[model samples]
Target: MKHYFIAHKLFLLFLAKFFLTYILLTVVYQLYLGGFQQNQIDGITQLVSQNTQQLMRVLDMDVLVLKDKGASVMVFYKQKYIARIIEGCNAISIIILFVSFIVAFSGKIKPTLLFICMGSLVIYGLNVVRIALLVVLLDAYPEQTAVWHGTIFPLFIYGVVFLLWVLWVTKILDYAKKTV
Candidate 1:
């Protein structure tokens, strides 16, 4: 048992750090969300919806995002109701997961923090674009809504995160080799 533990110490450390960071951040996010009334949307989700509206508009799409009486925004394009932007659409949960992985294999404090911030921004921007694209595409192909929303978009977002993780790991590995 001792030999097994010794041989896999780094992997164990990574798992510990990843889980701890993930849990801590998730708890904090839940607490922040808990402060909002059940009928109201949290600030992050609201901002994400608004940003999607703006991006779609910039692309010359006739888009509108209106706050519902409940905890979501109604998205309309071409004057037709297309979708709803909810808390899950905001991508904070995905950002939390991404941050946890980076912190788990963390390098120096400055680079780690910088990478976290940059990676988060990338995730946020991409999420907004994802939402916008989904809205537009769903409006066009209502019959294929399930495929677009359930499979394609989720795969796209997760794929980007996986790519970012690979980049971070490779960069740190190179740094480690140079310092040796």
Candidate 2:
């Protein structure tokens, strides 16, 4: 057991950092969310929804993103209800997960912090675009809503995160080689 711990020390450290960061960030997010009234859309979600609408509008699609009392933000196309932009649509949780992984395999303080900020912004922008595209798709193919929303869009966002993680890890490896 001692030998195993000695050999796998780096892996163990990674696990500890990942979990601790994930939990701490999650708790902080939950607390931030808790300050809002029940069923009310948070500010982030509203911003995401608005961004999505703007993106769609830029693409020449008629769009309106609205927030009602005690309900998720609604996305409409040509005055037709197309989709809802819920808290999950904001992608803060996904950003938290991404940050945790980066921090887990952290290299230098400056680089790590910069990567976190850049990666989070990328995730946020991607999420806004994803939601915009999804709203358009939903308006076009209402029958495919389940598959598109539940599977495809998730795969797209997670796939981007996975690629970002691979990039971060490779950069860390290169940095390690230089230090050695």
The prediction achieving the highest lDDT against the true structure is: 1
Cα lDDT, all candidates:
0.93, 0.89
Give the Å shift of residue 26 in candidate 1.
0.2
User: What is the C-alpha lDDT profile of model 2 across 1-180, one tens digit per residue?
Assistant: 999999999899999999999999999999988988887888888888888888888889889988866659878888998878788789999999999999998988998999899999999999999988888788889999999999999999999999989888776435456647
lDDT of candidate 1? 0.93
Regions more than 4 Å wrong, model 1: 172-180
Clashing pairs in 2: none
For model 1, where is the 10-residue window of minimal lDDT?
171-180
TM-score, candidate 2, is 0.94
Using all chains and alpha carbons, the TM-scores for the candidates as numbered come to: 0.95, 0.94
Error of 2 at 71 (Å): 3.4
